[model samples]
Target: MESGQGLGELIPPLADSDYYLDHYDDLSCIITQGLSGKIIVNGQPYEEEMLALNNISLAELSNLINYMNSQWYPDKIEVNLNTIKAQLANCAD
Candidate 1:
């Protein structure tokens, strides 16, 4: 099922802001026990999206937080948006 119209057709690219580094640094410092993070999507604060992402069993949520924490890298300016899929793999089965 690899009918490639190119990946841009499936997922539009997001814009990058010059000030994004501040937020990226902020995210790396968040407390995993009760993460209170928000990411903007299409120019709006996306708490709903964040909530949906963490919607899972408690163990999985903890594991997901751990996975995210482990993945913080200052050198990687481009977010692997698909990395969420990789992090989910670390969640409790």
Candidate 2:
């Protein structure tokens, strides 16, 4: 996958059982996928903490990418950061 691709585009699809089998040991993946409604592992329902963690991960990833791009390509990075900040603010409400 390209570095510019979004998380949604980068994530691969997998069956619920298969996802559990592959990622049960990886708490980050399990929480992320579960919060995104992509997979249900071990019959466990998605919880607030999982969703929050997913959101934090996404936010951090976005910020990191934006920062990197900002150092290399200022204009595009500012635009992307503004857009992401707006989206995050909206999500807060």
Off by over 4 Å in 2: 1-49, 54-59, 63-79
In terms of TM-score, which candidate is strongest?
1
lDDT of 1 by residue, 34-73 (tens): 2335544334443322223333554554454444434533
Candidate 1 off by > 4 Å: 1-55, 73-93
Best by lDDT: 2
lDDT of 2 at 53: 47
